[model samples]
Target: MEFSLILKKINNTLSAEKELIFNDWYSQSETHRQYFKGVLEQFENNRITVDNKKGWERIDQEIRKKNSTKSYWKYAVAAAIVIAVFSLPFTFKNTPSDLPPTTTLEQQATIEIGSDKATLTLEDGSSVVLQKGEHYEAGHIKSNGEQLLYDSTKTTPNVDIAYNILTIPRGGQFFISLSDGTNVWLNSDSKLRYPVAFAENQTRMVELVYGEAYFEVSPSTKHNGSHFTVTTLNQEIDVIGTEFNIKAYKEDPIISTTLVEGKVVVKSSQTFKKLIPGQQSKLDSKTNSIEISKVDVSNEVSWKNGFFSFKNKQLEEIILVLSRWYDVDFKVQNTEAVKIPFNGVFNKKQEIENILKIIENTNEVKFEIKGKTILVE
Candidate 1:
């Protein structure tokens, strides 16, 4: 079997027949087992000592070099091992056992992680705090702790359109179901201004004042073909029926809209772009321009599914996300540390210190938690 096939087996991407061939090849000779072990050892050593980008460059050079005879297979195996190890760091994987314990940090600090908490601003300007796991009812809207649901059965005659705002604070999240059956999940530090009940014979409109939100818009067919529009600071997303996510934080440098299903039209002051499923449109604040790209919809909507998924993201970008979710502040003492790239999948319910410790295990940097502030060095 070719070393490429064996490498595919190692990454668990091989067909069953290829896997059997690899197993038979491994058992054919003790030399093959030793070679595999040596390759793994070399990969581990390089993972710790070498820069990731430089390692890939070396692998590229090896691929360009021509080799004849059986020795070529050995080089191919080595190159494959290096490629696997480096690429693993850019993809989400299950947390391995035998990682460092989180007891010390948990015992020393008194920090509260963000949860399902939000403030609801009623149409009359009265604000109510929605605590975690607490049920609340006001007008036709009902909250069963986890999400707010509207009872469309208790509709009143249209007088004037009444607006309500759902504000999720730092370290908090929330969910709401509108009377029109549209569902929204608000991320930390997000504010959504929407009507208490959409008016009849009018276009449904809402404003995402700031931060991130995932929307599962109800079909217009159910509402007499009415259109739903979400207006952000930089652009507007018009939907007939679609599931999408928008990140428009006031402090962010770009406003991003990612479509998961169906279709939508994203309009800015200068131009309008139409998005299909699995596409994302980003509005750059500096240039006032819109750019579109294909994206992994699962990664973009992972937060709403109770996981933190990162792909080739910088340490500083990850830290900013953690700050909002943990309601903490970060102070980086080393400027270079912020530029380091990371990729991982973490449970949202994991302890803040435990997550930081996992990053520390990379040995590229360290973190010091002082109260609610994380000092990165």
Candidate 2:
């Protein structure tokens, strides 16, 4: 198969006959399979924008210069795949030499990456601080360090509903398994209010007071057709055995509900919309409007996967996300710095300094850490 045709096949743009031919070619040699794997990795890591002709020309020149005397067709093919897949043209200017030396001054102490921490408010208004790596049992609810789970062994009849709130502070995350077996993953600076034991034959309801959460609803069949509902500030999501993510931070202008699987109905006071898999319903808080759009479900739920996936996100927006995860304050010295757009994925487990370094390496802005505050310029 021609190298270009292989690229087309890799991209799923080839006919069935060509795909079969490409698969046969790949199976003939381990070198072909390895080359294909490398190409796939490059395509995932870098966003290639150059035209096909230019990409091939650049690859041909590089191969000729590096392996002129070799008769290695595999080497040539690998080189072409790498060049075609990973050629990102970065034009950002380097960091200015005249800028002040970056320093890490003491603000308080360096805040660590967010861990499993939360405050569980009981039905009596008293609270329990859930520490990392510690297990506790409160009534029918049991917590195993990272997650709070309701014991299924205990059964509750029709009774007055009692609610408890799990509040995750800045630089903290937590998980909870409701009495109905539904699971919720709460992000930093968030709160989930749910019943300790849901009443029999009643709707399983929870409220995301603020921030973000990813929910995996238990099948209604298991609960005698009891529906699941998530209440946010401006919208309500009705689910039936669905997995979805909701971002309704009070600081954000919109409440976004992205469905991963099954179905969800997003309802505001004015209107309602149903969402299928890979679709998102965004409710505008200001206008009280609901809009539906197709989205990359994985990107929307990347926080639950321990990464920050930014797609053309503004510097200020990125700062807000980082601030919550790192428990730091941000002060942008240059006004234009907040307007700068960034697009990339970064590990959420990294230290605040290391994460800032990745942004600084772009050379669009620099960062200085003063205690717990990050000054961006």
Candidate 3:
């Protein structure tokens, strides 16, 4: 682990690959863990913490504060002292409105962080619950609780395509390596349907079923020029050796397909839009139309990188993501607060209360945790 990783994690700019390296270092020693915590304190203390309620205004304040350069300098000096001492590295969806606005519910609750978990439904409709430390296998498909993998080389010819569905529950996530070498990172409250193996000399296909996923597709050139495609409720993505993210949660009114690298063509009933890196195509569920726009790809797919990025995200959006991962519900008593925006990057492993505290610190929004339900005032 390098010193720069500490900076990246604190800044919420750490990538998925670097995160693994940081984690390995973090688990090695208690000294490393203490150093990590110290670094976090320095960084968080110096930076002007910001969140949704105030939207981009808070972001502007943070930017202006950074431009002053004094806080960052202090943080850097503190971290440098840590390096001189010890080394360390660091790393929603909708909601329902089922609460009565007149009632105020506040109770202490312990919301644990989610881990790798999912329900796999085989072609025969038999379901298997996958959780951390558990193992399951069928034919060439194997899952080690953390990830599911399929061995394409062991596939049999002339057999009908056996379909399997993987459903991710709230407060959980899972990874899968498909038969074609395509890698998929599934977020909380998502589901995907795919074949056990693809037929030779044909297109490989899968469906989002619902929720969010980041796909790293195996190029067609590697498979005799066979194509790969992903179908969601709103649009279909034609891929040619690319990495992309799709957000199509059941409660979300808009379906977003963000291309991180390479190429992808998003098709809808109206027309098809080809997207390049740093571009996102949003399909409105009500209109059945696709709109293309430039976006910060890093922020767009930050969740896959083990960070919940709230740049330009509204309170409603942030809450949806938080609710899904924390397995809790948030009731916004101040309805208009739902549109409030926040700007910050948080580690998913951080406690739900820490985040609630941050938002509450703004004084613009107040959150009362009542068991699994939070009353947002």
Candidate 4:
């Protein structure tokens, strides 16, 4: 028997004695440590670890054929021991979907975005046809190829008076520039409202109606009340200068505020919380409560970088995010599957079917993709 098969058998064995011996040898050797490190490095860099392992095994077989006196069982046992030890922790890390049977339910819902085209609604309730262009300014606003820009000069009464609504369709995205020079990257199915210019004495405030957005707040050396504020649903975030991401979809139960830089004070009608970098503030709608916890910043902010990151996120949470990004509906046939958490990452631009295929590879879950609907079982 080969080392891999022997190790797999030992892992599945009900007898504790064999498992203990295998685990001990696995953890006690430096040779095993080097092998495991090599495997991990190959996997992390998107190299083929399984192929490399097979290549090593082929070399071992060739060497053994030349020296019949050498025993391959000896190396197999050594490798088996290490594999047994490392797999113990991993075997216990299965998601809820890997568990026993449970009741199932079917859900049907639709996702809607505020608008489809990239348009600007002026302060006078009129509209401006802003097409894809380079460096164009109307009043105190400007836009590049991908985003709109806002640049305003403070004056005695702040004569510049302009406000507009930027709407992104379900499958559309846009960029915007705030009067304070803050840059915003709005995801699909998102809407943002901002003034054309900052008020002379008022603070800068923007409202997010739905979906996700990343903000890089520009510093303000002038304007005593130069703070940046973002309002979503019933919660408000105040920041002096910071980089942050907010997911405040109306349909989702929890509103998330993940701080990337500086500080933000998230205030509700009756509660408030301060968050630092790498911290995520979660607000629950049902109870009107807020909770803060340290999170993996890269995992939370990866979407802004055009990556989908799932750090053991519940299947329900993953569905919510997908629903927003893909502008689709989720239909789960098994309620028990909601408890399952997935840990994975892929480019945001990848096809939804590709992402679902990766999830199905786990073997504990299956998916049915039909048009804009995803059915998980």
Among these predictions, the greatest lDDT belongs to 3
My TM-score estimates for the predictions, one after another, are 0.73, 0.74, 0.76, 0.66
Model 1 lowest lDDT segment of ten: 92-101
Please identify which of the two predictions, 2 or 4, would achieve the higher lDDT against the true structure: 2
Per-residue alpha-carbon lDDT of candidate 4 for residues 1-377, written as tens digits (9 for 90 to 100): 12333334433753566556556655863333333343343234332122324433553675467653223333322332222223323343444454323233233333333222366687888755444554456666666646776664633246675668987766566777676678888877778888877777777888998878888887655557578899998899998888888988767889999987788899998799999887999999778799999987766766655556665677788877777777888799978766766555555554565455445533446777665687887
In candidate 4, stretches whose alpha carbon ends up further than 4 angstroms from where it belongs are: 1-117, 127-139, 152-161, 222-225
TM-score of 2: 0.74
Q: Which has the better TM-score: candidate 1, or candidate 2?
A: 2
Give the alpha carbon lDDT tens digit for every residue of 1-377 in model 1.
Answer: 45456446546797988888888988964335644554444444334312434443454465457544233333433433333343333432324332223223333455677799999999889998897778898768888777878876433346777889999999899999988889899999999998888888677899999999999898888878989999988789899898899999999989999987788999888889999887999998777689999986666776775657665578899999999998899999989878966666555776777677656644456787788888887
Model number with the top TM-score: 3
lDDT of each: 0.74, 0.74, 0.75, 0.64
**lDDT of residue 332 for candidate 2:** 84
**Root-mean-square deviation of every model:** 12.1, 11.5, 10.1, 15.5
Instruction: Write candidate 2's Cα lDDT for 1-377 as tens digits.
Output: 45456557657898988888888988974334644564455455553334444443454565566764232232333332333232222221323352223344333356888889999999999998897878898668878778898876444666778889999999999999887778899999999998878888888888999999999888889988989999988888888888888999988999999887787889999999999887888899998899999876656776886667665578799899999999889988978878866656555765666556545533457787777877886
- Per-residue accuracy of model 3 over 16-72 as CA lDDT, tens digit each: 999989989989743356556645754554343222223234444554677643443
How many clashes show up per model?
1, 1, 7, 4
* Candidate 3 residue spans exceeding 4 A from truth: 1-107, 156-159
Worst 10-residue lDDT window for candidate 4 reads 76-85
